[model samples]
Target: MIKAKQIVKKFESGTNVLFAVNHVDLIVPKGQFITITGRSGSGKSTLLYQLGLLDKPTSGDIELAGRDVINMSEDERTFYRLSKLGYVFQDYAILPSLTALENVLLPLLMLGLPDADARRMATDAMVRVGLEDKLINYPSQLSGGQQQRVAIARAIAHDPEILFADEPTANLDTETSDMILELFLKLHKEGQTIVMVTHEKDYAEKADRIIELADGKIVRDETLRRN
Candidate 1:
């Protein structure tokens, strides 16, 4: 599903060049749930951003579904991001003013779907995330986990090829975090391709593979088991 080779992301820091992600190569096949775990500032998120096409690497080659992604024009990359990728961040990334259903359907509308189609798809996504009853609730009206579920619903409403989560459980309580992790596991069981960045060891162990990074490099890549 994704191939990245010799990826490097550098930043200028007071006349010094710092590599946030350095010489990393990774491959994620279809339907694999991969967890990237590392300490703070280890570049795990940086690598994920590059792989998810949120940020282009300073130097590297990235291929998604076998098409080279690094050299695409800005518009082309934006189109690909909207059509092929889904993201869930630690903050939930939902608009507070929009209701749960509207939050999910808004992007579908942006993708040019008809209002009826977008509404139906949004409802289905909410159902999949176990949020069907809360569709009309505003963000401020829902619990933290429910809001995050709404975010997840939004991410999958259009059936993106790859679902990327960056520290998805960071802000929730333990029980809520477990619930969220289990939800991701359920989606993975149903053939969703997931790449998640997390710090919790037990949660990270649930994935098909674990990638450990440090100092902008992969220190360990372990397969806990094949799913």
Candidate 2:
């Protein structure tokens, strides 16, 4: 569903150019759950931003579903992202004032979905993430895990072709993190395409494939046995 060739993202600091993401090539097939794992500065998140169209690569090409996204204008990219992609950040990016259901409804409403249809979709998404009962709760009223589930529901409400999660379990405890990972696993089983960036090997192991990064390059790509 996504392909990147010789992707490079660089930043200029004084006279030195830092390659946040060095020359990298990747392909993510439809319905495949992949994880990118590396140390803090290994460019795992940088590569993800490039692939997810959240950031443009300094050089190289990115193709999603066979169309080149690197050349799209900012407005076009925004539309594409809203229509086709979903994201979950390390921090639950939910609004403090919005109810969980309303948070999920925002994107759908942005897509011009009717209020009633949006509500139904949002409710379904919340249920899928085990947050059905927390729909009316505000972010501050929920636990960390519940807050993250609302974020997840918000991301998936539109049935995006692919879901991108960047360090999604970073803020939770061990048990909560496990629950979140299990939720991701459940989504994968339901054929949701996912590309997650995580520092934990244990979480990465749960994915269909794990791509390890080092110095902004892919050092290992392993396909795990799906039991």
Q: Model 1, residue 151: what's the lDDT? A: 90
Provide the RMSD of all predictions against the true structure, rounded to 1 decimal.
0.9, 1.0
The local distance difference test score of each candidate is 0.93, 0.93
Clashing pairs in 1: none
**Mind sharing the TM-score for model 1?**
0.98
Locate the minimum summed-lDDT window of 10 residues in model 2: 218-227
Off by over 4 Å in 1: none
TM-score (all chains, Cα) for each model: 0.98, 0.98
Instruction: For residues 79-177, write the lDDT of model 2, one tens digit per residue.
Output: 999989999999999999899999999999999999999999999999999988998998989999999889999988999999999999999999999
In candidate 2, stretches whose alpha carbon ends up further than 4 angstroms from where it belongs are none
